[model samples]
Target: MQSFRDEIENPIVQKEIIDLEKKIYSFRNGQIDDERFRSLRLARGIYGQRQEGVQMIRIKLPYGKVSSEQLKRITEVSDKYSTGRLHITTRQDIQIHYVSLDRTPELWADLAKDDITLREACGNTVRNITGSELAGVDVDEPFDITPYAHGLFQYLLRNPICQEMGRKFKISFSSSEKDSALSYLHDLGFIPKIVNGEKGFKIMLGGGLGSQPSHAELLSEFVPVNQIIPTAEGVIRVFDRHGERAKRLKARLKFLIKDLGRDEFLRLVDEEKKALPFHSYEIETAAFEGPITEPLLAVPSVTIDDVEAFEAWKKSNVIAQKQAGYVAIGIKVSLGDFYTDKARVLADLIKNYGANELRFSLRQNIVIRNIKEENLAFFYQELAKLDFVTLGYNTIGDVTACPGTDTCNLGIASSTGIATELERVLATEYPQYADNTGISIKISGCMNACGQHNMSEIGFQGMSINSGKLVAPALQVLLGGGILGDGKGRFSDKVIKIPSRRGPDALRYILNDFEANANGQSFLNYYDAKGEKYFYDFLLPLSDVTNLTEEDFVDWGNADNYVKAVGVGECAGVVIDLVATLLFEAKDKLTFSHEALQEGKWSDSIYLTYAGFVNGAKALLLAEGQKTNTHAGIIDLFDTVFVETNKIELSSSFKDLVYQINKKEPSEAFAKAYIQEGVAFFENIENYRAKDLANA
Candidate 1:
């Protein structure tokens, strides 16, 4: 087989591929630890599935933008490597499942030919940087944030700082204050703003959705456009320095900010500014500027069999672009899964009729932009032929769901199953809501919220109910959660838990009540007026397990009895506490610090060295079976357990040694000294571990 090393042109990418191949070989041969291997593969977007030996490859498309060529390329790769099915995630990445682990490198190489990447798509690194799907063309946007979002993604991808963080970090950009990108649920949310006609962004920090959802705090009302990168770097640096590590659930930036208090967190962020590579990294928007296209051809007169159906589709699916004489079309990808054959047809249709570029929305749908106004009928007809013309683009009928038991290891129930059923209920029973954009529905198989259920107007989280000795699949129905725009949102309140089979009935009851009493108000307004208790009271009967028939025990889309089987989750990767591995990683960080110093990256060198110190200390702490939760905690515990106890001697406290990065400017002198400190720390830990092993 031809190696990717020869096929890939970029030296850096080639080296990355070669390294992955080497690591995979080592892992397969048992030369690498299982936990360490899991982390490595996850960082490269090769995720383990519930069905062992197969992988789920997540292709990272920054801001969900994909050209016709790229989409076709993806389809080709999917067809060759796995099932001809493409799954779009809420973060706007595409995933292909049941892939052989050995073929991932080949699959990735094929993707890179079309400028697609899989790096950092998973694991405790910066996930795909998402932005408004309509960023460039949104009429409400002060300016196109496409360039800025792309710029940030470029700056952070494969950056040393976030390569191996405590947990995954998410960032998003909204085109306007409407926050269509759902900025409020991201780790760092950016909304475009204009200050005296100068571009800026209102920043939101530490927002996340998991089992426990917390709204992001407003980090800054407005920061100049040029400062976005630098400010983001500063925030990441702080997160790296202090974010929790030991506990998987509490490791998110939101928890860190909550624990430290927002004021302290911001202070730390401001303190890291001096170490930033650039004080103002101005983004060049030339690449993302509006493309010049040929004049639109005359509208083709087509006989419509159902004018009313076509009009409804137009009202819900077509969005007016800021660019005059053009529009954007939204294609509701049911449950975000589409076959490769249809994908190819859609790709060709967009390339021939519309702009060659398209973006996948956070709601797991596609938005084809720059379509000539006159081509709407023609485009609809072409799309209808492929069964891609769905009327409810972002309405309640358009449900977002994660691939729960179908693939996800953490899924307790079938999210996609229930989501499909609920969408059917809407289409067949509640057809009046075909164009109603007043509400949103989302589902997640687990509390990790991959489906982003916590931020939807109506949400369902997969759970299990214990009925006497029987445990059956259940849905935790939540209500009143949604984005309030401009870095504001609410987490859904769990109103009731019911059998998974009753999900459609539960939806019917809620919708029936809302339609009767809402008086044409939006779902959010009606929800607020009705209050949580009122809705809970209304849906209370659904929670009665005593009335469940044998069918109720069966999960959606499953004919057999539902079994609550949840495998290990790979979303956060694995925590490898092997002493040798930890020490080896510390040495690797020290080597990285030296490289950064040679490259004139003083701040990068300093931070790399800091990580070296933390890893080295964590090795010793793990040896003692001591808990190391955060970087701050590791430093403090190391001083007490090793340095102060005289098991290892140091010139100063471990806290002072590691925390020096915060006090001093990231000059060459300090960076050199810090690298030396890291080297000494690694050596000390190595010797201690060796001695301890000898004694054992």
Candidate 2:
């Protein structure tokens, strides 16, 4: 049980927390690294978030699987140390946010006894290694890849060569044809296969999500079992050597893959592989560890009641297990947000009853693996306590919005609030359209597009305008973007720029249109029968006003971005977060010197400019979260950066900043140079750093 001191109200702790922040920042700035210093930083709750004072503590639940006891611990830690919510990320890892600056180390210690880890979850280090939850147990009859995934994890965890890369790299493992794990969306996607009777892997190189997204290119036809490490090493080497270190925004693997054609990228890998000494492995079964035997289980007795509902959930959400009498249950969580109490109770129930194996899903949900038929009823009842068992109906309100204003500092329009309100409204008003399956609507507060609104069946992104003298907030809508379980993946189109308020109605209008013209058929079948143009015309109609048109066009998802100086934060869209830290060392100087407020083209409207400043600052903080700039310094504080970023009073700043700079324009080299000069200015100081014109 947790002690009373763990609570925020505990005396003799708040000051300690304050002191801890100093130590953490000191250590981060390289002032200290002693064990005591490190321990103090950890103890103070100074975790390495994507930024300073922002803590992102990633808990390792082996193989994307968490035990109930472990889960309960997570709940406790979150409730005590954080905002009391846990985010089940795209990777099978659980991330907690709004974590206090000092309670971080204590949070780490709380889970220390249970074999969980928070090390390397953030920073310029290898993040949590993820794999298919059912690596060995899928009855689909493919090779088990648990050992391979685990082996890679062990080797890469703090391995001198991989601890730091050109950028963060994610590796995903899949055992079957099903892309359930969305392995192709990762930097290194490993698929298990046998070649000439020996187990091996088919490696796909250089895929990622972010400002620039790329589908991995198949590199190795058959990487021998022993050579997986070296091949991966080659991929890393190529990335580190050729990665865009100068331009932070364009520095991801997707751009690398784009720069290097598929064949050339593989050729570089092959060349790197040729020089490395290979270590072969003794062949064993290549999948995962066998299912946990009941003898090892601490499961309590469960009583069944609701058979029909359970069966229905099992039909669409649950999948077959390799182990008999066991099934994998998928809990359809909305965007993977879990509160602390909810986490703790669910963890308790899961640990005591489930197989001590909890799987996080890609669509932001939790799954209990190896659940017995006998326990379904009891588990259902328990889940209901934590709000785990809600039926999902796909509608305008069934929107998947990222943590817009809740935690992230870069958000413009509060994606979570909008999504919740929209989902609630849509669920209540349009039952027919809301209940439609095979449909998804996603929202991202800003153009950095963490929400991946670009891939939504219906998508919304935050945008703003100088509506007369007042700044007007709105959402731009994109239609038809989606992935397919049926192998017909198509990207959504930027059909209309819908306002934030009209977002739900616009979506409902489209779905209802789909409902009317669907001609009484299945989802995909209807889309197939009615081609893109037919559906486009039906949804958009003749005019946009009485016909329902949204606000402005403000999205360019994963298709190469422009020279983005500052992005919108998940919390608020700000442009000058670093100005205080950068412009004035002593914040007290603000009273004497009005330089920042006066000479800096910063608008006189304190309310509006301050809001933009907050948004821009948060966006910069989030950009810091990407591990691109870790020196606690600011870059791109110039007129070009601020004007494009909306830090200054530019009318079309958002659009102009997001406008794609043609790769081949005026020689791609010169265009890249201008961007590079702007990016490199803040850090290098003498050569390229430009004064902040907006707050000069």
Candidate 3:
């Protein structure tokens, strides 16, 4: 209470009010609109999100570590104004919704109290720094990267030079070879190691995923870890000085990295490192805890009988401690959906009943460290109230899924739903898969691919396909995805695709096959050795039904007369749903019927081709039209839809193109195609022509 009052006291509030009043005086003739203001802000690296009237603010949670004080502030601010739900994103960020724009200042003030804030949380800026989630706990790691992650976060947050760059940049730290952080796939990846008997990091440059995906290359080896800040500053300086400032879509670090060869890039980085502020002790090894805390609970003193399954739970669910007898218990939360009220209750319990330390895991789960055996039952009871404590912490559909169409306009499909469905199917057809601990599966809704599907033992990406007039749903299967336990790392391979509706069957078949073939190796290792040929050869036969008489309808995927076939993932939903609706009768909303036509404005023919777009640019056409509507709505929607459609050409191959909402710029060719497609599809609808290139 004393601390709260000391912090919120007065002159600060009045100073802020005066400052804001002064800033408000510079408004455009005292008549600025939200859109214009938003655009101006965006151009300068600010963002505005759509939630309720209350703004939904996104703040980067890089590498997923925050100070205890920061966490308390988050809770306090959230409770004061919000519904109190903090979403931990797949990119390792925290987002809060239902905040009023007017209250933004107040919210910011509260955040400032804890040295936390919303800087570069949106727009085309480098997001929060991310590090391996297990950085401080995984014993297999060479060293904990928490200090470095925080250090970099401090250095990068609103840095003057980094405030403006060619595009958003990403950085990751990996002390372990596991690469669970997926460092190779980021803009900057740091791998811990010892070179010349000196401990430091092997830094990689120019890695990212966007329209074009590229892995980073090694730039410097054994750069003392302490030199990270200066080395980073130099690299950013170079990027700031040299990265593309002309093309918006082509401005990513990957483009820069691609433009320069590995050797030259390294030379540049080395040259830049010369002027950096490097310290000798920064790269030295730092200590961290083990991956799993041993069960902190001691032997029971009373005659309390527990189920046999409890023993398995104790073994598989609880990780052992580096220290004798102390265990870390993982309590998985489905969808990471827990109430703020519940968090308070749990925090109170930890303070009074359990250990003081509570750790949040990347799997959208939470852990309580060092609980005495005698208090296990009591701790379990408190967690049960929040509906988070479960014996099956890592089982079934406790699947990792990035936010999709639900919140991110960038999504092509609904990943959360798909994850739920997959879990249901697996549980329905094969319960053992849920209980199977060896295989790790992940899913993503967009090419942003936050689920880290590329490295899962088995992974799925949401997609769509055109089946006549109906848009059929499907998933692309990625196999051979694996991360090193410690730095020998290789991501999995893409094996096949299957209909989304049939995802469960495909997963079961794949898992069962592994079960039978395993000569005692883990699922991931066995699948790696099983090779691509085995999977393709097995799944290929099911793609197109050869003969009606031979096709097994009982086990095969078929809704009515159409058989489901595999297709590309990511933006696949948009085009395929378009195709499916155009060809078949409607069973679901994806049909190309009146309901679909009514969904948006671009469903008309005037949108097709660049010629049509150029011709339709009659600014004041609403001057005399019988459409019975103003041009305002039409113009806004047209720009929104067209921009998304045109932006996916580069990475759509890897993305599910079911719907288009590209964050980058579209090409002339792409814009031409979009307009043409829009015009043609809408104009000659009764005599639809999607089978040929003329329509596609």
Candidate 4:
């Protein structure tokens, strides 16, 4: 760790890596609480896997953009610290599994050399900012949204307001009205629009996909690009202060929007305006506005053995770019899994033959941009050598799935196994759908929707079905979910549940029925016309358990009989309620407050000081076995249990003391005074607690 620290040149990042190393050491020595350590490691992007004593590190990539150099750097780090296999997530980040927790700081330091990061990639913070891979080159886009997406990600990566929220927050940017980024299913979604020749965006708020999927409400029809950051910050502040903390299931921003109507929720966001650090953040767009300047180099010559197959590949996998004479090629990664050796080869191919950059698509596929149109045959032959020139790019044959029971703690069934079999079924039985991009299939190990199963045209969620004394892996079939463009969409309805081995037959039945009766309608339109019960009646026969064979008891990709074992999920970091740990965290908050104050970030310092007060008061409340849920609840309860009861003396009511954050403007004078007050409050609480503990 010390050697890596010396190699890292950025002082701020070096300090962060060193701090993580220290925290890991303390946690290993049992000096930190289990829940506290879980939260800490998750914030740094080290996640616990289904198997013990190993981790899954999520490498956050803004808008899923990666250059050739960065790709090589990632491959190198994966080879050193983890398995050589990389898994692309739905949000366009790369995940490497089976990593040792002790080496995370070193791994992070190495990636930092290539300008990559793992900070705030997981836990209750704002996750990786996602957008369309076609942002700059899509034919239908009004303007490029790359710089704006990049701008927002930079502003919020380590913002104090979003570091510790009630639940994870997701944000997305779409290139155009096509909404390729799935704007309707994020906490905040932005769709680029040019109104009166001015650059602006239509914002969607409070949308999420889980067991209960919710469509985002339109927060604004148009806000200038300069105001997007401030608008997002305001919404995050409201969520941090008011979102549920005690109930894990009810902690997302969507639930908060449901509890408080959209009107009231927006009103709270408006109330946070005074405390915001900026009224509008102007995104620097000039860097993204440019034309291709590649020299006209000599094209390489190659021969294609299978002309028919090559033509089919060109028809399906090749995409037209907004830039003339250039095209983007899509690589349909099977189950979003790719090994390091092929990745290195692919990176070199793109660097030499095409643009040095690649963007991971939202569907867990790779899009290589800036390939000259004239060199199609040569590039095809090269890609065919890597076995990457598959016929389908983003069609029904390209399935999106999560690593269900394979590595996820919450997985009850094998999502990847069933997904693979289904993909094979589509390839062998329904070849016509290979280029049919209208329909989509997605699967998740469980109801958490990590695979985004709830928001696809056809979806499957992992589950288990019990018959007498035996249990088998099961899948809940769903229908009628798709993007409706411009921040509107529908969530799939649960249609039926069938054994995992029967998944391929279920897909065959659905597709066969659609082909016979749909009569040229889109999949979503046909599902709407037929209604839920119409398909349920036809597919219900597969749900029968009495006719089960012995093979039905064994799940997909497994040789033994199925056994259901679900572990605690850490997607939303665990709540830490230990009294001593809470008090210690309060002191840590003050240290952070002083750092922010010294850096001249007034709003950040104020919020950190405010959090310190709440944490200190909550520590005393928890010492008495009181329930502390929301920040507002903690303030009121602290006043009730401590101030009003005179158990702990204070200059004023706790609510009056802490509520000053919202009531007063975030000026440097106010921030300094707030830090001082927090210092005094901590000293009082620590002394009182020490006396109380001594007496007990």
Candidate 5:
């Protein structure tokens, strides 16, 4: 542990790891509150698991890019800190489970030695920034978006504005108009666009998936590359100032846009331009512009033992790169689970044979880029040694799943179990679909959509069915959802609920009908043509609970009877609304505002002051037993409960005082004055609390 501490070079990162260690010690000693400690650990990517004493650590990899050295480092860290198993998430992050809570600081320091991080990977902060796996090598892309994605990830990693918000924020970049990165389902999504030969992006905003899925609204058709980061600053400022705070489920940016029309949301975004740190922050793409590697002197000639298998692998897993004479290979990682042994082997294979870089796909697979076209056979043979060469890479056989009951606290069923069973059914019986890239099947243990199940062509959500004096594991069948490209898509329709044991049978029925009657149309088009009710009727028999046998009481991959037990989810850190805690937080934010002001970060200072106002107001509102849900609601309610009533007098309304953040430019004078206002507001609240307590 001391060796790891000595390896850290960045003073800020070193301080972060030290603070985490101290916090863990305080929490173990009962010096820190449980809810407060949960927030701290989650923001650092240390999450409590379903099991009592273990944690799940999510390793954030920007745009899913990993170097051979970094991959080897991750394997080493995983082997030392936790189990050797690595789980790839739908967001292109790698999660390792069953870790001791106390060793996280050392684990984080070890990761930092290779320039990998765990910050903001979980909790109610900006999660990992993702991009197209083929970003730098896609033939259809107007330009590489890798540098832009990387820049955003760097700029916001430990930024002051998003350290703690109401809920998690997600951002993505699609390499092309295909929207392979699923742009339509993120808080902010970017698709490359070229206007008059100038590179830009088409922005999508406020889209999300949970129990309720909403499509994103088109924010901008085209924004110049230099202006994108500043635009993002404005958008985040607005979200931070007005997003929800108390109601966890309703706290996402989508609900705010739904409450206020898109026009008003964009108007607010425009209003924050004056508060942005940079009017146009340009990203340097020179380093990512050219080819990363060249072919070796000679192509190795080899005889293939099974030419048919080789051809199938090529058709399904191999992709031609934009760089001629090079190709990218896809390795289908089943259920997003891989061991460190295979990881090390793949790391060596990529370093020795292919390009030294790899990108993890949103579907939980790995894409090795920059392999010479002539070396495809050689690379395939090398990957085969590690059992890493899996065909049907992103096809129907390649199912996407989350760590359902295996690790996640909110898991309701066995997503990994069902996903494995479905893949087996597809490979053994429906072999013809081995190359069918049109359909996608995804599963989530619950409706959280961690697996992006609600947006797949065919989807399943974990649920339970109630029978007389008994409960059985069930899946909510969904249909007709898929990406439509260019920031447009549809959510799946919940067709019916069926027993989990009949999951394979349900798939068979759907595929059998589609193959017989689809008439060569894609699954989405056929689903649209046939309608939800038609399929619902066809699969209605599976929904019958009266015919359930003893096996139906057990879930997939489980030997015991099914029990519906869901733990508290830490995906969004627990909300602590204690009046004292809120007041302390307000004062802490005021301190941060002063520090940012000294650093000449006027935008950061302004946002910090705004957060202070919100926290101070929410503290008083909670003292008065007022419901503090949204930031906007807090401001308005404070004006009603205190300002209007003369309990706390001010020159203007509370809304007017707080909303000045958008009206005034982020200058030194404005930041200093705003800090004064926040200080005055907090003092007034403190005095009122003291008087109220004394009078009582």
Candidate 6:
């Protein structure tokens, strides 16, 4: 571990790992607060799982793009640090479960060697930027969104504005108006648009799905390519200032936009423009345009023993790219779970026979790109060895599901268990759906909707039914949800709830009904024509829990009877109001401010200094039993409680001192001065707190 830590080339990343190690030691020794430690670890992409004393480390793969070398490196780390399995998230990141907290830093160092990161994959920070899997190859796309997604990810990583926001932020880029990335459900979603030959995007803001799904509103008809960073920065600034902090469920950007009207929110974003570091940040797209790398080894000659199976696989998995004579191959990773050994083979296969890059799709599948038309059979034969040549790639049989009770803390029932059963039902009963992409099915462990159940034509949310003193795992059936393209979509309506064992029957009923009455309409249109109540009427019998047997009490994939065991969810980092911890965090912020100044990140340095000031003030405010719910509120309250009362002395009012961040540009001179002042302010706050403690 020490050897790899020494070998880490990036000074910033090395320091981050070292700091994580030190923090872990502190946490183990009872020197750090549990909530504070959770926040720190989550920012580094180490998340707490349902099981005790283990973690799920999410490896951030920007836009789901992974090179052959990076894939090999991930497999190596997974084999060493976690279970030899990888779970592809709906957001296009890879997660490995059951990692020890103590060894996370070393594991991170290993992944960093291949330029793969775990940073910001979880926590109240800007998460991995997801994009359409077919961004570069889509025939209908105006231009590829790969570079923009990559550029935005690079800009926001470890950036001060989003690091400590009230809640996590999500961003997505769709390749075209097709909205394949599901733009309507992201905090900030972009769809490629060419306005009079100038490349730009139609911006959608404040979209999210959870217990309360909110459709994104149009932020702008068009934003030029270069102005995206500035736009994102402004929106984040406003969200950070006024987003809900005390209420975890209401802390998302969508809720903020809802509380403050869109007009007022846009006004706040406009106000933040003066303080932005860049008015127009041009992205370099050339590097992402062509083939990542030519195949080093020739395509192996192969013969298919089962020609019928091979043809069926190719019909669903093969996707033609916009580039002439090239295609992309899709691998249907069931429930997003794949072993590391198969992943190693896939890495080598892509490197040797095709372009050395592949993307993990938003539906938790793999897409290998740049394969030659003539080489399809060979690639298919190679994939068949690993059992990757499934019949349905993105079709109805390709059910998307979260880990559910298998790993997630908030799971009420088994999602993967039911999803697997439903997929089997589709393959056996409705084989024709394998080539149909019109109807999509998704499942979530709970209402948090990690599997994105709310935006599919058929959806199920994990739930539980109480039968007097006994409990049975159950699922909530939802219907009529579909994306309408161009940053528009509808959330599924909850239809009925049934026992987990009855999930297969529920799907059978729905499919049978659709087939009988649909009259050749699209699934969404058919669902709408019949209405939500119509489906509920037919599926009502399956919801009966009065006659549940012993088998109904046992959840799918479990031998024991179902017990509703839910751990405290760490989806958003816990809120810590400890005065001492806040003071300690203030000092840490000051240190980061000095480091950012040394690195010449003026905007970052200035923001860090501002955060330091706010944190120090909030510590004293909390000591006085005052509320510090938002940064703006903290600034105002600190002045009234301390500065005006003459309890603390400052050169100016606390509001003026902290508000200097947005009043001036992020120049080197201002950053240095702000950091120096922040350091002094920390000293003063510490002295005041000590005296107050002595008096008490």
Off by over 4 Å in 6: none
lDDT of 6 by residue, 419-438 (tens): 99999899998987779899
| TM-score computed on alpha carbons, candidate 5 | 0.96
lDDT of 1 by residue, 419-494 (tens): 9999999999998888888689999999999998888889999999988878889999999988788888888998
Local error of candidate 6 at residue 151 (angstroms): 0.4
lDDT of each: 0.89, 0.54, 0.54, 0.91, 0.90, 0.92
TM-score of each: 0.96, 0.68, 0.67, 0.98, 0.96, 0.98
TM-score of 4: 0.98
- Backbone N/Cα/C clashes per model: 0, 37, 64, 0, 0, 0
Candidate 2 structure quality by residue, lDDT tens digits, 1-696: 964235444222443434445666776776654333433333222333334466656665445867777777787777777677788765666778767655665666566545566655543345567777666668863677777777777666534334333356677777665644555566877777677797777776666655445566667667777778777766765664455543556656777778777777767666554323333444344344554645244545665577687665555556678877777766667767878777767666666666666777555667777777666666677776666666662233446667654455465665775677667766687765533556777778777666767666677777653434334445766666555421124445555554455666666676677778878875545656766666556445322433322232222221221121223221110112232243222221222123323433121111122222222332443433432231112123323354454444433333333122211222233333333332232233222224333434
- Answer with 1 or 3, whichever has the higher lDDT: 1
Model 2 ranges off by over 4 Å = 1-54, 60-63, 123-125, 194-198, 274-288, 295-317, 393-399, 429-437, 484-489, 519-696
Ranking by lDDT: 6, 4, 5, 1, 2, 3
RMSD of 5: 2.0
lDDT of 5 by residue, 254-303 (tens): 99889888999889888877767788898987877765765333446777
lDDT of 4 by residue, 57-144 (tens): 9999999999888999999999999989999999999999999998999999999998899999999999999999988999999999
**Model 4, residue 305: C-alpha shift (Å):** 4.1
Candidate 4 — which pairs collide? none
Higher-scoring candidate on TM-score, 2 or 5: 5
In candidate 2, how many Å is residue 196 off? 5.4
Off by over 4 Å in 4: 293-299
lDDT of 4 at 250: 95
Give, for candidate 2, the lowest lDDT window spanning 10 residues: 568-577
